[model samples]
Target: MNEHYNRWLHHRGLDPDLMQELLLLSQDEIEDCFYRHLDFGTAGMRGLLGPGINRMNLYTVRRVTEGLARTLIAQGDDTRKRGVAIAYDSRRFSPEFGAEAAGTLASHSVRVYLYPSLRPTPMLSYAVRHLGAAAGIMITASHNPASYNGYKVYGSDGAQMPPHRVDKILQALAGIDELALPSHSLQDGIASGWIKEIGSEVDTAYYNHVLSLSHENNATANQQLKVIFTPLHGTGNRPVRHILGELGFTQVHTVSAQETPDPDFPTVSAPNPEEHDVFTLALTEAEQYTADIVIGTDPDADRLGLYARNPAGNYTAFNGNQIGALLLHYTLERKAAKGELSSQGIVLKSIVTSEMGRSIASSFGVKMEDTLTGFKYIAEKVDRYEALNTPFLFGYEESYGYLLGSFVRDKDAIQAAMMCCEMAAYYKQAQNLTLTEVLEILYQQHGAYIESIFSFTFQGKKGLEKMSTLMDTLRNQPLKQIADLPIAQVKDYRLGIDHLPKANVLKYLCTDNSWVAIRPSGTEPKIKFYISAVADIIDAAQEKKKRMEKDLRDRLETSL
Candidate 1:
């Protein structure tokens, strides 16, 4: 075994002070932990918190931050002078990780604006742009379980750092052979003004921006609109409720048990808004209040989930695609009705997202653009449109993430929450319809667009190799048919020759308007298969989706 791996194993066997604190770990765990350093991908570093090179310990955090500091210094005096903003979520070691990052930056004489308490990911993005910081760091694992944590970096534009800059950050990280930082204290940095504490002022500013998005003039006008909201035990509680109250959502009900931040996320297994089971608490409350709508944001509050009453009176969670289409249609339709629709307006969605958004945008004479799978790509598109003097009307991904008005470069669940409420209220007034009804109307007008995502986990080194091999195999041998339907073309994003920038992905377009995409997860050790199909009627779409899913399963079984 390598020296580092042996050290990890020795540490595991000793039952020493540090080892005990990290909980029970086996030899295999030690090997996996020390095998390699956590990767710094397009999003940044993420891994389980433990005492290994591959783990998210203080040493790894410092090394990454030192590298970031070096990159900032290389940019020149102005960039270093502007510094970086830092925030943490309510997770184990999150605050410590934030402090370590700040101290590393301070060692290089870079200013840091660290949040006084836990803050959402979107707020960190906002603070970066609001403070004119050179970059930003948010210590969070998002909706992951308690065993995981992560680091997300943002650029000056407040979007997740783009691939080009992230590559530079990785290069700088490699330049530092040692993980230790020079003698420096985060407290001392704060005392010397190199680090500043951000608090309610920024929160108040962000809440004000959310309130400005409200189209409801009379708070009492929508008082009858009963709403239930849950933060899923993350950082969205304060802002989501504050904005709802400010917008005069009188009957806004909170999932009382889940309103507080808990690092353990005791209520749910994953704390993800995309999961139907995570709404257990909110659904229970919704039942009591007879709520018109149920909304949930994940741990970091960048993604939003919606649930509405069906004609049968049972609440059903709307998938990300359904919500995205509704929001796009509503935003444009309202703009047109108010005579605010501009010729320069545009909508952006990830390439993997539902194409129903395109139909909605086209109905209003707005241009729709597709990017790679990350919100950063969507933000980049927004930046491009802004430079061209065009307007950004809306943007979204298939993972329950949405953005409106571009005030915040990343996904803003707070904005999505408010807009969804407004859309629900508008439908209520205009057609006496609920969100579910709005979706039915959309299905009737446009072809029904159905999408499903399947994830296969491949853990450890061997699993990683297997995942790469699988991607290569798919690239080398493309699928000609799925469920007897002919595939028209294949899109290989990894080859860097696509409609958008290159990524490590393959998309197969089928003759029957069905498609399947394969890509590695940016934040986890897994691969995701996204299947989408569109048809003139809901029954046809449902039937096609069934066949496609069965074929995909059979193929994966045989190929893997």
Candidate 2:
């Protein structure tokens, strides 16, 4: 069977290097590599960057773009003419992939706006709307390991292209039965005026908008604040530093080792900001500089990592929920204090995010809404509110993704970093408190709510099957109790309630103020358990969370 696939791929014109490797792989390795096409869902295609149909290589990139091309063509001449915008991160072959996509679109007579160099994901979202294009493509695997790459699609609205639209693109992808298709050369496309490179103009606009999000225009506070930032060797170096420096953040320091655009991400085990260890170097710099705050963005610059000084003068790290709650509280308090907060103000969060921010919003009389676990859903709500002429104050997910302004339809870490700086300044200068102190204040006001996510990764084809079976068992035969806590409610998102799209997710609410949610990750091969616990005291909340996690994990292990 492996030999059959090897011959088939060689005949289909796969790259010679990849074909050579296919012939050398062990039988089991070949089976794993050729067992299936990398599944392209709402997150687009993401996988290891290597040979085989299951990987993210030139062939798969072109194949996905070809699908997008056919989808756009079917939408009529106007849509095709509006064309697609392409941007890539600082990953291996990212530039080449962007060019391949642009060339593929250009082959179909579609216009293309290609970024000259690596840029962040949110900028691609901004470019889609800024360029008036019908679609956008970002070549990034977000904060995944250096070995992975991805292709993310966006609609004209700047969000990840919604599900209904993705279905059409998938249909187009299914129709392409062969990889050896004639295509236009990148140079020819550029010469023909169909492929355009965009830079500085969009960067300027993005920087200007990010700067404008600093409502607390206390130049003295900003100048006085000490900050340390790292881009984790991805695409955020230039823009993040430029925006901060231009905004009067005079005392800024960066981790020199991780400042350059190196796809290998030599400094960290993973480029993801969510992991505690990714901040090792940044934390070192923070201590050396005695910085008031530390910030790091993932490879694509859409997700942000934050650390701040506590009352004890010790730097403390915050999880995504804590960051979101802080930003939400800061934005609301400042807006309401200045009487700038609208009467129709609303805040959005993913279903899996902590509910602490929800309580904070209520205290400020702002509506708090929950979408499924994706920034795109949050953006969808933002778009609806924009159409309704209502106010969108904030949107965030627990995965370090956040959006503060409507200027960009996806999570903007640049915006988050700016606001976090300003918020830290506000609490320090005006309120005489640190971020940790402000968080304590919020906790006091709304009871202590703690949230954590545990992920179990299963590799290879059998691992995928194991994950699927786990979700199936949970959904088909629901849990009646966990840790002797009675179930208060069960929300099966697959049924699609509360005006949200259907998804394969299960949430079990306990009688106590705690809950557990189970779902497969959209972009990776892992089953994530979202657990949240609340109590009148911080220690009690932490204890409850630990207990819930232990009981549930133990039960899951026994069942397996």
Candidate 3:
């Protein structure tokens, strides 16, 4: 074991107070805690809250912030003067982590604009650009469970720091000799003007930007278009509800059980909007109100999930791909109808996201670009497009993240919520069709696009080794066919040399319009398999989907 891990173990076992707590934990639990330092990846740091070197606590947050501060100082005096913006979600110790980060930056004579209270991740991204800060920090684990918390660093462009710069940050982190809590108080730092508290004004600016995305002014105050919303016990409750009310959405019902920001997230096992369990309360309320649409945002409100009512009154969640495709088509059609579709208008999506978005973009003659998985890549593309005078129309990923305007660099669930409501209304008013009906129309026009995501979780050191072995096996041996489709092309992002601009990923293109991409999650210890197929008819699409899913599962089982 490393010296740090040994010290941590000794502290837990020898310290009387700690021993009392340690006695309750199993051997496996203790081992897990002291196994290794929580990884500080390109996305920054994330882990469970504890006293070990591997945990997320004031000391670890300070260490990372110190590194960021040093990196800024090295850039120049002007960069340091520009400072960093900080925000936190409603997780346990999130506020403390935000304060710790701010105090650490202040100790290095860097200015900090910490949010007055918990704020969404998009707000932190927006504040970075809005204040012209050198960088930004958001203390959130996003959709992770309540036990977990994280620190995400953003660049001056208002996007998460790119991978190349993250390497530099890691190098700086390595140079720090001692990882200890800062001596100075964040409250004192604020009093001395080194740390500033920001609120309402930023909220107004963000809300105004969201309102500007509306295409039509005639929003009929209809109770029949009932909408139900839940924040999943996170920071989105006030902002999402307030935005919906202001947008003339009259019969908007809030999930009372989950309308408050509770770090414990007592209502569900996990606060992730991607999980169906988090929607139990909201779905129940939706049925009672006969809501036309149901929407929920994750802890930091960076991702949005939607459920639409079918003709049989059965409510079903729409996956990220479907939502992305719908938003792309709706935004383009409206822009063209208003004669506002510019020659320079552009749409962005992750490489693993549904290609149906690309097809929709093509139909409107709008440029569509694909970035790597993270929203940071999408934000970087937006920054590049804006610098070149290209108008960014929309950007999304397959993980329930979507961004509408350039006001916020990362995904904004508040904006996505409002836009989805508007899209649902437009579809209803124009064609007397539901959002699902519009989706079917999209399938008929452009061949039906079916996509699915499969994730395999691996934990601890052995799990990491297993994950690496699996990736190596897949890379060395290619699949000849999947579900009767001959594999025609293979894209290995890990062999960055092969692709020139390398990424750690592998993609296979079958002879048919079906494709599969395999890549490890940057923020989590899991490998994701993305399968997509496009067929001429609905029946063919269904058949191909079943076969592809079965083949992928079979291969994954054997390989594992």
The number of the candidate with the highest TM-score is 2
Candidate 2 RMSD to the real structure: 1.4
What is candidate 3's lDDT per residue for 242-314, written digit by digit as tens?
A: 7777778878888989988999999999888778888998998888888889999999999999999877789
Model 2: how far residue 24 lies from native, Å: 2.8
Which regions in candidate 2 have their CA more than 4 angstroms from the true location?
A: 2-4, 7-9
Better of 1 and 3 by lDDT: 1
TM-score of 3: 0.95
Candidate 1 local lDDT, 269-378, one digit each (tens): 98899999999888888988899999999988999999997777899779999999999898888778878889688899998999998988887888998999889999
Model 1 scores a TM of 0.96
> On lDDT, who's better, 1 or 2?
2
lDDT of 1: 0.86
**Model 2 C-alpha lDDT per residue in residues 305-409, reported as the tens digit of each score:** 999988787898899999999999899888888899986988999888998888999999889999998788999999999999998899999999999989899
Clashing pairs in 3: 493-503, 493-505, 494-505, 496-502
Off by over 4 Å in 1: 6-24, 175-179
